[model samples]
Target: MKIGILTSGGDCPGLNAIIRGVCKPAIQHYGMEVWGIQSGFRGLVDDNVVPLEEKVLSGLLNSAGTVLGTSRDMPFKRRFSASSEDKPSMMMKTIKKHGFDCIVCIGGNGTQDTAYQLSKLGVNVVTIPKTIDNDVEGTDVCYGFDSAVSIATDAIDRLHSTASAHQRVMVIEVMGHNAGWIALYSGMAGGGDIILIPELGYNIHNVGSKIIERLKQGKPYSIVVVAEGIKTMENKKAAQFIAEEIEYETGFETRETVLGYIQRGGIPTAYDRNLATRMGGFAAQLIEGKQYGQMVSLNGSTIMPVPLEKIAGKARLVNEDNDLIIQGKRMGICFG
Candidate 1:
């Protein structure tokens, strides 16, 4: 069987590992030819492909980005270029001409939705969930979550020393889109004074009070962590607003650090590499089993396939009532 794999959506840390994982098993054990689709579906539309021999897959286990490259371009959204085609008919024609027995999609929620739409057009597709957000539904965890959380947590840890020495309020912004996993985990792990996630909208006055209370307790420094997607009444960014509010409320020097793309880059953590490896191999296994229109997912300790319909148009947001939040509350961590 000739299998095609593509990485879509925002770039993540474990993409190359997934490519290596799939190519290794599919080529050696299953005797399947692997073809890489470049730049997600846009590449597919343009017939851009590269053969994935075993040699190309080597030394990529520890790599961070996708060798096949990636883009956020979608078939339904003509956002990439003026010449972009939004129709799947062209995609179907390209798939038929290439004779891809099966195709694997490595991406997050939007990518999965596109995969489902392609499957409906009679394309044989399997998906692997990958995002730093860890918000894809029907999976316990995604591959890139560990690596991103580690980076964000490390940033927070380093910020603590500087904030202490300078006696300032440091507002660190981490990426989460709409979920609070990154903010919550990094905050808990790095001992943040306050955390703000999109799941729970925060009151500026309450946050100011907390900073003032910390100051009253003789704590000169404070560390506040927030998700990039967190919003205020006018959908403004939280970092600058929080910093200004805390400074006015406590009369302390406030600084904002946005860990933008740095969290998305760098080497994949061991956990992400292992997870991507398992997911990729499992995707190959599914293709070998003739399982189409499914997504390879992790349920507890087992790797398995889930129906595409279940994952499309759905996201797994952090549960406000989960144990993590409860523990954070118990530990006196502010989740504003």
Candidate 2:
């Protein structure tokens, strides 16, 4: 049978590994012809593709980013629209013209949404969750999360020395885009004094007071880990704003470091590499069963198939009552 594959939305560390996993088993064992869809959904609409072979999957298990390439999921706008409703129909035509029995879509929430849309349009899609946010529901963890957390935590740890030596409030911004897993894990591991998440909006006044309290307690310096997804109660959050706020409120010098793109460009963490490999292997198993509209997910320690429909509707969030929140409280980390 012929199959099409694509990775969509924000790039992740385990993407290449996933491609290797899927193509290895599908091509070697299932004897299926796999076509790599270039540049994600745009490729689907534009009909850009190439055949994928076992050789193409070689040595990709340890690589970061996707070999199939990727694109954002914004159905409202195609890269270049020829006409209204023409794009979606054209996307459908690509699937038919290529004579693919099914498609494997590896990506995050936005990508899943795109897959669902395609499914509704009569193209069979089997999704694989891929996001560092770890916010995609139905999966205990998604690919690339470990690498991101590791990168953020390492940055936070390294900043401690400089922040302490200079007696400054170091506001470290890490990627989340919509979730707090990166900031939460880094703040906890790196011993950040303040951690901000999008789910729980903060009152900057309280955060300001915490910094002042730290000063009074003889801790002249503070480390603040902020997720890019979060918003302060006043609804103002640009990295520069956080730096200025420290100076304005506590009268202490502050520095800002936005860890944008840095967390995304490193080697895959050991955990991510293993997870990606396994997820890819598991993806092959599902395709073997001829399951459609399903996604491979890691639930606790087991690999499971969940309907792509449910996984697309809601995002998994950090449970407020979870152990991490408790640990943060014991460390006296402000959630503001």
28-139 in candidate 2: lDDT tens per residue?
8889899999998888888999999888788897876777788884653554455666677778888889999898989888888778877887777888888888889999
Clashes of each: 0, 0
lDDT of model 1, residue 152 = 94
- The top-ranked prediction according to TM-score is 1
Q: Model 2 segments beyond 4 Å from truth?
A: 76-81, 232-237
- Assess each prediction's global lDDT (C-alpha) against the native: 0.89, 0.84
The candidate scoring highest on lDDT is: 1
Worst 10 residues of 2 by lDDT: 73-82
True-structure Cα RMSD, model 1: 1.8
Report the C-alpha lDDT of model 1 over 272-322, residue by residue, as the tens digit. Answer: 988988998899999999999999989999998999998899999987897
